[model samples]
Target: MNNIADRYLLHAAFPLSMDNESKSTTEMICIANKKSVQEQQLLQALESSEQRYEIATKITNDGLWEWNLNSNQINYSSRWKSMLGCSNQEIKNSPVEWFARVHQADIEKLRRNLSACGQGDVSQFEMEYSLLHQDGNYRVMSCKCMAIRGTEGKIDRLVGCQTDITRHKQTEARLNYDINYDRLTRLPNRQLFIKNLQELSQIESSCLFGVLCLDLDRFKYINHNFGHQTGDCLLVKIVQKLKSCLRSGDLLARIGGDEFAILLAGFERADYPAEIASQIQQKFSAPIEVENRSILITTSIGIAPLTNINDLEHQESSYSLIEALQNAEIAMHQAKNKGKACSVVFESAAYLQSIAKFKSENELRAAIELEQFELHYQPIIKLADRQLVGFEALVRWQHPDKGMVAPGDFIPLAESTGLIIPIGWWVLRSACAQMVLWQQDRPKSKLAFISVNIAGKQFSQPYAGDIIAQILTETGLDPRCLKLEITESEIIENVNVVLSTAEKLKKLGVQLSMDDFGTGYSSLSYLHCLPVDTLKIDRSFVENIESNIHELELVKTIIKLAQVFNLDVVAEGIEREQQCDRLLELQCEYGQGYLFSKPLSLAEANNLLESVNN
Candidate 1:
């Protein structure tokens, strides 16, 4: 090895026609002849190394290239020509031919990197770029170049290898898709949705934009009744339905379980958000097959329009893309509270109200601490004898600062902030205590029970049963004489928890009533499964029962629905004598509203009780 290294060094110093000052032509020829053995050995080593490099490159499937700087010529191996989707005979051996095949956009980048390498600013050239294939489409390729400097320290030649990295690029893209897309629905996931929002916010455009945050109603019930596999099929059907309602540029993404988001753009009408939301609702309501069973579902949508890009930019520091999403979610909750299958747009006033809402939450805490809440009872009477059967307990806030605040104004704020948990407990306890007091004052009072409305959040708690049992024990009110009213939507949200709670409350001897029945997405199958004692007709149907026959039939159907389960039926908002007559004709078990007696203060309720008893 040492002898080979020494002989190779001598040949490397003077390869062919050396211009050494001390050597004549004759002397050089004689010396070259005498060292012929060493020259032959060196030649064999050089050929072997070249053969090894060629074999290694072939095995790796890399196409080798060499460019002659002086001649502006290029040499391509057979694999290099094939990489460009061309036959060996189809390519030309010229530097211009190689440069021409580069994609227009990538040409500048390739030039920049190569120029930097040639100037000795970088040691090697490496680039991942797109090169035009002979078939006209582009192929992703990875090419690396290095300068071969001559004895004069000048870049005399360039050598590089080109690899076809198209498969690698496809694999990377698939991995990215899995990361940013929902596996079940194939809709863009939350991360990609946020990225899309950020990009949209940064773009300069005159088109008005909005976001629709949609959540499927009664999704949990579906998930519970049907298996997860069926639930996934439903999700895919929903995504397809949503896409039918979208424009070319709009984006639809599944952002959470049973939740999807839509980005709206290029709208001329200011009411496009509502129209689009209605289209989405209509499309979603169409029958879809899940495990060969056709089912229909409704969506509650919340629209948040991007008002001013400049304002958004300013708000970005304090509120990022999440701000818009939160705004949409807030509006969605508001719509859900109104009823199922509804859409609500976020107004600037709603945003401003949030500030006031924060103050209201603090006041709510104070109200609970100071017992500023008052329970007013509205009389529920039997239609046949106008006899008092029960009283529905309604809470009121006598705010010292605001004089009086309506439940509509503050209850939502309380529900959102989870203040409803404590407030609801207080109402149950206060109503039960008052009922016990009224029974004591008028021993002959016909009040069967006090019905108090329960908030959804409060009812969803695992400890909700415990709270009611404790209230019944503390107030000494007979559990049979206390009724709890919960909305159908609440029962639908957490079916398992609410159903379990209802069973426990029943075991405690308390009656459960479904409030505002026939207004939500509760199926009869699900309703029958609940341990409910009564169904209260929503006020909307009762108010216009005479004006609309459909409303009449709906009310009648509700009464029959209760009859099938042998549950008591109560009609609300019976303001007119005709409405009372209509209820009597329908044989509704009980009725409540102005026709009976308005919601009353404790003193007013006691006076009424005494009057009825007399």
Candidate 2:
């Protein structure tokens, strides 16, 4: 107050006539009061600003930090220390403290960024890095900082804000994992497998690499018999077994349902892929127990090798990663065709065959639409009387361009593509109608039956019995005049379903014959259980019966077994008189082969029937 009054009095030229002491005292009181008011206002404004800054820091949850470049000291806000789970007293106001809290891997990068800002190369910098927390875990943090310059235009200090992004980072990682991994097996999915293949293709390595495509055999049946829940558990167990067969560096992925693939890299030996496939198959030999049910399964595998990525690229300019996978898949299908539970190595020949098969499948579909198929009937002879009692219907493809295509050329293809279903129905209806026509033409003559071959898939259809009955009603053919022949393998593989189908057909007065018996699973155990009226000896045994005594004995045993079951025997492929005589001597009831007559066209068959009646 004294200095304020003295300065005020010295600056002010008040009236000299008044008492100097009294005027000076009054003026000093006024100046002192005004100075006190100004000082109080300034302090209030400073307090308000500090309160606002604290609220902002709290609202934003941003930890503030200031670094004095000259003194190499850092000032950390209380909030900053608390962000790392530390108290203000626990942290020191020093750059060393901040640097020590940074992750070791991120420390060098942080220093380099800070150096750039200090050198005035950047006005500010933003970086996301890992920071060590007080809980001994690293937290992802996003830091934004700006350099403050001094009067000499040199960096004097740095001020920054750090935000904890640990949750955000975890969410990002989880999303990435979900996209690339299978949910059921936790293995890499198809997308990740393709990505890995692409990455491998980019590497300039001479080491050999390959892919293995595996498919579970009869998995659909398992799914149908057991519920999908059990099937899923089975698949998981299968993954565990497959993993045990893989090398450490190999990658296994579940590409699709019941289909898996393995990527083998850096292997020098060409046979290594086959060895792994064998091991995997061996592991499946033991039955897997799932949900208290012991399930047996096998896999078909295909292997495609990549000897040199560069060479492959050079060979096909349009080469793609998907094509590599497709090639392996094609080989896997080939293995399935050869018989499941085996592995096939991809080759140029197999690729070409796949292409051909694709074309042929399309052609077959078109042919079915255009009705380019016809039935040829082969006469079935009663060996004792040498009389024609029935005819077996065979399918022939009357190709528009290829003249006549034999069943051997396309039957397997038809079976694989499920074309056999429609084609099989067509044969059945045609054969039955033709038999009705023959019966109408010669009402007095007896035509025992017309035998039609039914495919395994067609027979397995639930509505097969109903469909056959409908066809019979439509054609006005006696069910007793139509005999259905199913292969032995088809019957044995699905005995329960086949038995049901057989009972249904039997109710319709249709006879069942086991076609190609003795060629596959000649299980005498199921023979008596089947309600079959006849057993047709396979052509292989009949073909060698003349010269092969072992074949003759097997034929004898088959005939005796048929007799024991009270089932009629039909010998197929009797190409020679000796074979026919031998079959008759064995008491085989019926026979059909070139020795009688080849499969005949409709007009030829009509002529033959008339000749037999005459």
Candidate 3:
């Protein structure tokens, strides 16, 4: 092969380096001929290589650039100039000239970053900034540079490439917004809320701040009646109201559907946050026009105060916000249970006391998963025939340490925490399975059905029908033998979804009953609209049966209503013999509660059933 010196000279000057005019044609020929055949062959190889590189650079669309830090001169490829809608003549080889083309809004940031590289603070440079096109439009450009340091460790040369990443940047921005903001209402989502909370927590101040978690009460009922689209529209309208009511600095976020969180920072006085929350509650209670009807919406707000300001001293970190938010939500749910349209602020002492209970809820969740819950069946007997009809499933928690826990103490807590869905499924499955076991032993008794009281939240679950269907199929229990009981208020609140769910169950041959019938403003027309097989007279009416003539009349009317609809009638909470006689007198088909027996265990209930049938 040729010498390295000849090959290097031949290759370097092959493409861009043209023969000098000062050099005569004879001198050019003498220089070319003086080389041996091997060197000539190397020159030919170098020329071929230059042609390929020149062709490749010209064909590719990516913009390439070089910057000379010493002279502040910049050289950009022809395609690079074209990328910014500029001609070759318009391309000035100066950093200042390049910065001038950068969008004004992004210039300062780009300057700071470049300054950091000049000061030896940064070794490499990469930035995404906007460049003004010749057409006066801004296109996003991504620049990547390598700082060439001299022997003194100072940057002497910088080379970079600028690519038009406008489309990619737009896509990235859209993705970021979709991640951090709610798509329906365009409000900050839970992730963004936590981030803001963390940032706000870092301010060096003695002033306290409050985190209020609010949920639109009975939103599921609205969704069930008006459809999800209308529900979403209402949520968006609610978000607008919430935004209007907030202070300029306060952060409002839609953390979950129907759930929101607000950060009230820099409160000088402790009561300020509470006052603001109360004002917000009042504002939210105002009616909104939807579907050509003015509908009043209420929110349940729970507030927790931030005591430690130094906790989040970093740019982004979550501390106590998520926990505080969760506690506020729990307290809000507690207020909702009292009644809707209420607000509760978290007291540290009260929260401390309640934290144990909340922890126990998680423990109870584990217990349910591990099958630590036991079912005690309460007998419902035929008062007229004095024969056992069916059993009501009552859940008892046999806590490893706390012993037996009452349903009243924990069921509401479970419902609020979303643990009720699993618990309710277990109840239905266990009850149906037990009923199947009973039928196997005593096929002759011919008990009417096992009644499982379902909560409103459980009934509202999207997969509730599937849960019941699976339970029935898995246990091999006749669906007709399983009575899924619900409250009158639950049905009345979500009348449409309730009716739809009831029809779905009825198609599977499961009996539907409205429990505590007279307690709510259930219209007779609604009763027929729902696919119910039975109406349960509330125990309140039974307790005052003989003493109150009105109670007796009401019970009689309910029984007559049931008869007219060809539905079975049962009176619950029957505690007295006189109440039983009154119910029998009213021709109520079935009765339950202390009149016959309180909720018993499976063994006690089965034994009683066997004896009564015998």
Global lDDT scores for all candidate models: 0.85, 0.88, 0.80
Model 1 has an lDDT value of 0.85
Cα lDDT tens digits, model 2, 325-359, are 88889999889989899999999887997799999
Q: Assess the local accuracy of residue 502 in candidate 2 as a C-alpha lDDT between 0 and 100.
A: 89
Estimated TM-score for each candidate: 0.55, 0.62, 0.58
Candidate 3 TM-score versus the reference: 0.58
Clashing pairs in 2: none
Q: What is candidate 1's lDDT per residue for 1-614, written digit by digit as tens?
A: 34446666676647656666679989978877767866676768877987897787667688888877767778888788888888878888887777898889899999888777767787787898888898898899999999888667888678899889999999999999999999888889989998888877776666777889998999888889998888888888888788888888998898999999888877888788889998887787667878889888888999887754555666453344457787888789778888978999887678777667777788889998998988788999999999998899998999998866768877987887888888899899999999899889877777889999999898889898998898889999999998899998888888899988988999989999998898887558588689999999999999988778999999999998889899999999999989888888888979999987999988898888888888
How many clashes in each candidate?
0, 0, 1
Poorest stretch of ten by lDDT in candidate 3: 311-320
- Model 1, residue 553: distance off in Å is 38
Candidate ranking (TM-score, best to worst):
2, 3, 1
Pick the lDDT winner: 2
Candidate 1: 10-residue stretch with minimal lDDT? 313-322
Candidate scoring better on lDDT of 2 and 3: 2
Clashing pairs in 1: none
**Whose TM-score is greatest here?**
2
